[model samples]
Target: MLDRRNMLKTLGAGAAGGLTLAGAAEAEAALTAQASEALGPYARPWSPPNDKDPHAQNIVALSDDYFVPGRFAGKTVIVTGCARGMGRMAAIRLAREGANVVGVDWLADEGRAVIDGIRRDGGKAVFVPGDVSENAVCDRMVATAVDQYGGLDAALNNAGVMDAIYPGDPIDYDKQKSLIMARIDQASDDYWDVVMRVNATGVFRCLRAELRQMMKQNRGGAIVNVASVAGLRGFGGTPSYVASKHAVNGLTKNAAIDYAPYGIRVNSVCMANTATPMVERAMQILRERARATGEGGGIGMIKTKSLLQYSDQHARDSTPAEQVAVMLFLLSPESSNLTGANYATDGGFTTY
Candidate 1:
């Protein structure tokens, strides 16, 4: 019955006993390694992958200078949408900083690959494959964290959909044009419902489950929702996405206020056009439309008018690492007093 608490006590006792300092240090290292190995292969360290490795390419490796080494040691974090993009980056970085991560996503294989990369980097992580829009999946995510790593300490609700989920048929240009370039009047019920379900209600479900777990533990935790710059203001031709993001901000504030007394903090990172798979898909759509319409200036002109909102400071899209930096700060104790804030990681796009 050697639990974590008892194991720690034993280590302390060994340090104070007749054993030399170096001997005690070696003993502790061996015990820690054993404990990690007992968890699973993913908790054990492996050789780093080569540059040409597919999983290695998927990983967004941050410089050692960016890490605070063990800043989140012994913490357990749940990151939704951990398959790729911002969510993947956050999970890897947090694990590198010594947090035990439970990575969740509907993209099962991709999610597992990300978790594998984390483990290979000498970090602990597990993957949960399911959509965040489901209540059961949300509950299961929190439960996995508690069961695996003792309890939940923080979360990043980053799963979301920017566009409507189309059917299995070939591309419907008419529907695509309407969905991407339509106003509220032209947006279909399916378009609005699908986006809202995944982007707005999805976050709400995750937050409810996470907050409940934190409350039961009564030690408090942090939550960072991945909202967007559109949440701060109206963005033309994306009625569903805009409205859904605004809802995310609303949920963040409400939870922040209600949970502050319990020592829990809730905030959001409202990012602008970040360089993600989602954004790349969007650019591809715009490029197709531009070619069809005989438009000039290619991707650059389309991005400025649509994504960057003509802001000079946003001449380039942000990297997932840049957005994850803000997210990690909010989740860390460094932003102890920051809650209920919709932080604009928007490259000053929201300024104007």
Candidate 2:
């Protein structure tokens, strides 16, 4: 959840550098008093003391923290790939927290599910179908959020894809590489260009547009890029996935540093595989590998991580999307002072 770089940030969050779930209330009281003197007695909801319980109850964990209604009420948030996975999760929950949600994805059928879920919960959200890799779509999405929801407060650059074709255990590392290269070789120049363009450059495009709007609107805002752990380390044989993610990580750090003066906070989530469509396919490949090798794999490591069994019981023990969303909150205004950081949402995968 927190890395070495986050040690200082986490330490600053509680009494003597640590606090339990039960200690949040007490820790917040003290944090508030100290923060007031330091930040000049402001009552920003996203401020540190309030960070302890932005909502009454942690929506992810019922009856833990009281739900704070409308914490992001009237604020606009744009999430790409809102049709499914973590992006959908973030959008729906943010809407529940009172943000006007903009859900953009090329898959209308699934995207509509996200919008319906929001509306069903009495939350506001709109579904926009388009290719996020396209600048036109990106621009339309921003405009839609502003025009429909008023103005933007936050954006999650969460759209991306891995090689759907190469999903074997150990990735069959060499075979996967050869296939990807062959896929490129047999394709039109634009095909190879588009794959990298969409996954990597498209992120920069979104960030640039989002930053411009935030700056021009004169509204201090937050942005998150959904990069993967692939970007941080050398993956077995996922060349394009790894390279694109590396670019995402680089973009996030650079943007965070550059946008600091503009009151824009940018951060990225380095996540491991989850039980999403993309991940499931990868999991299947790894499962086959496991069958062949006769070795059990962990929850996230499909190929050969034996930390935990790959069963329902085991996944319940791993980190969930909501936990990663919490990291998003930290990088947002609730963590006004934190920026340029990558939070690992991999249930110790990164640490290990």
The numbered model that scores best in TM-score is 1
N/CA/C clash count, model 2: 9
**What C-alpha lDDT values do all the predictions have?**
0.79, 0.65
What candidate 1 gets wrong by more than 4 Å, as runs, is 1-65, 166-181, 290-314
TM-score, one value per model: 0.76, 0.68
Which candidate should be chosen as best, given lDDT against the real structure?
1
Cα lDDT tens digits, model 1, 235-305, are 76678989999999999999999999999999999988777987876666656656676654433233343
Give the residue spans of candidate 2 off by over 4 A: 1-68, 164-194, 285-320
Query: Residue-wise lDDT of candidate 2 within 134-189, one digit each (tens)?
Result: 88988988999889977888888888867534222245533443223222333334
Candidate 1, which ten residues in sequence have the lowest lDDT sum? 38-47
Separately for all candidates shown, the number of backbone clashes (residues 3 or more apart, or on different chains) is 0, 9
